[model samples]
Target: MESFNEYHIDPKEFTFLKSFQDNWQAIRDEFIHFIKQASNEDLKLVYDILGPKSKTIKTKGDAKYSAFGILFQGMFIEKYIQVHQIKYPDYGAEEASQKALVLREKYFPSLAKLIEKVNFNDDEIIRNVYFGTFHPGLDIKLHVNYNPHTNRGYLGLIVPEGDVAMKICHEQLYWHEGKFLVLDHSYPHCPHNYTNYDRTVLVVDFFKPDKPREEVIQFENEQVTQRMQENPYSLGVFGKSDRAKVEDFIKYGFTHQLEWDKAL
Candidate 1:
């Protein structure tokens, strides 16, 4: 609702950020665990090929850029939430799946509680969380597409820990571990991992509109359903069968990162 620079945002305007800043240590620890998760493990969430990216969007190559779902459009990743749906029957029972949860609980109870608090305080906000990662070179670029349908919480990116800085509008905004980079994606930006280490960010997308997030989602779905009724291919759900693709992408990035470190 407040006016801001089309390119950047001030952190002070957001009070909820303190919770995230305070819990940085725990957050980073969990993120590291997920990225290092090997197959055959149950606790970790392996990032699937973030599809429907800038180009292919539904393909792996195009997924490398942007903070994925938890998506570019606030799509909830299922593994964690499925647990909630089963644990709490009424979580989103009467609402739309896309933006129904009044509170979304994730892997870590503490983290889940934090998310709940943020939403609980606000009347209703469509908040989506995702772990976004980048490798060395220009490949791990943080390029958020200019999204007009965003507000105060346009995109809150916290670089858990890494030598990564985003280049936006000719400005190099270096990210500090635990600090927040709240900005509008309207301005094109490029974030590069200067070091060989992976630059991973805990991305939080809170879509705040005049109407509640669930209502916003319901309206959009209805509109799309109408269109789909006329044209069968107008809409399609992205599948979650890309674990191998996700691992391969991580392997490539992490392997190259290790190589870069060795070269240095």
Candidate 2:
């Protein structure tokens, strides 16, 4: 994988005129082609996994607002670990790739096929599979994902039914159902949901197949360890009694997860 610095695109280079004249049509055409290939049944499968009203989780950013996530890596529900006499599954990065494979094969085959086509690495492993949901009027600050160690992809499963929009970097894009967007998280970006309904997407991070498995695992370990140190609650690596504390932190202001973990 390339260094995070390699992915940074200067905002000045993305002028309105340049977009209109050079890039907008290409983006539009690619999205149109992707949508044409998308399956409605696959989209419904994702929604079913998420449910009509999904349980929300506290993320590293904007904890004051509600955000929901079903994580395949960096967290789990352990049935044996007891915190205050209550047992919860221990979640972490281990076996996350396998778990994601099970989910893709069983529930989201079509979506999986779409991802496989773009990610040509035959030995690639899913480093993270997250289903994130944000409600209407939610605004996320501009922040870089900053994980140059892995590749990231986002597939829009459900978007607002009415007038709503989402932005990546300086490009404001309308989320169309079943459309896919590949992104370099190391670059600065933000998301804004302006609609009456919730916005949901399948976000994936995976090791590119070209990298050796040992190197990939090492990267995953470093990333997971950093996350655990910075925000244990975000990883759900806490006792049952800590749930309220986590919720409170999310409701108010807590430490932002990645403030100290940037790749310097």
Candidate 3:
């Protein structure tokens, strides 16, 4: 492993960014084409891939001056935004991200394959972009506080070369290609730490297409930005209970046994 000062970012941070940047370009190009052509089918495909608008963050510092952690302050701001969404969804972009995180933690290796199957190849427009933000995918944020019970999922993929996953916990017990997860994310779950060199994955949240989008309020400048600070994971009583339940679900193993006739 490289020294923290050598790259300025810790190994985990460095790996996450490198993986994400590589993977997202491919998805972006495909999405850009869809945006330009505005084909009904392609537009639907884009919506399917990106979902609605994901969260966005304005950079607060210069990308050059900060060494290691210092030079790329804006990048960290975006990361914080992701964690904010994972922790707090009521005011965030989407509910899918946090839900997916919980699902991954609760169930082992269920959703990985479904996420991996996400490919933008069907769209002709995105093929040309070698690099750039051409994809219309929503920018959801994912936050994962360390948990001791289960294995944390790592993000990985073959194309566009960027990390689009939050805390992914790969499961060896139950996994099938394109059907690896038990639930779909409603928000963005950006990838964090891992051991692989080319660690990245295409993040796709599967949910009913009709899920309602939260209304967003935009501000013109920092005047509003200063007043607004991002908070991840709600701290309210209900929210705390929800988090605890997620932990409990992960701790207690799941089974298919159920009695349908009893309820009826």
Candidate 4:
């Protein structure tokens, strides 16, 4: 195999990312810290928890709202791929769903404890608020498109081998190091992979707030907005998003995630 030694990430960030791969508890702890410190108000917590960062990477398409979710360290994703017998072709969203399902089954009971540390109020929080995670392994790639208008992103990578490489791209974003280089999602980039190793990431979306009185009443009277959809890949097999009741939300839905849930 060609040694992509130039793709390695900095030791500090790599270490931090690694901590989450082996022990999600540590990741939860870090989130708790962000909650206690970064959040100044109740509503802000939702945004802060999901919002994008001001540093690390840059591309186009800045978001109207913030983007926040945890990206599994690459090494961890690799481990999940191995133990589960997950193949390179099975590294997309559906495969990730399977992994998470396994994870849910393996550690159902402990998730609540982890949630508690983050100060997530059981009553106020919706089940789907913390919705299921998204995992896209090497076969699944993310093409990040940034709006030329903003220089608000910094690209990062965390590879098992190679030195860290950083650059400014008006069009393309490549994964080179331990940091899964984050870029503005508004940009038009897509993930494409030809590698054998399965790469995975965690996608978390926070719950929408309770609507105000007038809007709630208006919404109650209105008909549901209908849109046509297609599921050619059978991705919906995971479960309905409506099933995301608050109690069900915290339960681990991805037992497959547990495949690599442990740090190797």
Number of the top candidate by TM-score? 1
lDDT of 4 by residue, 39-93 (tens): 2553353333222233212223421213333211111222323333433333554
Q: Candidate 2: lDDT of 53? A: 23
Writing each residue's lDDT as its tens digit, candidate 3 over 1-264 gives 323221122224222223333444443333334346555753443223222121232122221100001001011222323533433323343443443333323321222221222222211110001111222232322323211111122122222334322332221121111121222221112322221222223322111222222211121122124322321221100011112235433432221112233345
What lDDT would candidate 4 get against the real structure? 0.28
Q: Which parts of model 3 are misplaced by more than 4 Å?
A: 1-25, 28-156, 159-182, 185-196, 205-207, 210-247, 254-264
Q: Assess the local accuracy of residue 55 in candidate 4 as a C-alpha lDDT between 0 and 100.
A: 29
TM-scores, all candidates, are 0.56, 0.48, 0.22, 0.28
Per the 3 Å backbone cut-off, how many clashing residue pairs does candidate 2 have? 6
Best model number under lDDT: 1
- Minimum summed lDDT over a 10-residue window in model 2 is located at 79-88
Q: Is candidate 1 or candidate 4 better by TM-score?
A: 1
Candidate 1 C-alpha lDDT tens digits along 1-264: 543365567666666767777787787665555445534332212222221222212322333443333322233434323322312233342232332232223334465666667667854353455556665543433333423334323222334355567655545565667677776553444566556555666666555343466665675455434433443221212112211244445654565577678889
User: Residue-wise lDDT of candidate 2 within 1-264, one digit each (tens)?
Assistant: 322233433223222112222333343343334335547864443333222121222233442233222333322212111111221143333343334344345444444344344333433355444456677677765444545556565556666677555444334555555554555555545567667677766555655444677876786666655554454433421112222333444422322333334523
Show the colliding residue pairs in model 2.
75-91, 76-91, 77-89, 78-88, 78-89, 78-90
Q: Could you list the CA RMSD of all candidates, in the order they appear?
A: 11.4, 12.0, 19.6, 19.6
- Candidate 1 ranges with C-alpha deviation above 4 Å: 1-4, 37-45, 49-76, 79-106, 140-144, 151-163, 208-264
Q: How many backbone clashes does candidate 3 have?
A: 50
Which residue ranges in model 4 land beyond 4 Å of their true spot?
A: 1-105, 108-112, 119-186, 207-264
On the 0 to 100 scale, the lDDT of residue 99 in model 2 is: 41
Q: Candidate 1 vs candidate 3: which has greater lDDT?
A: 1
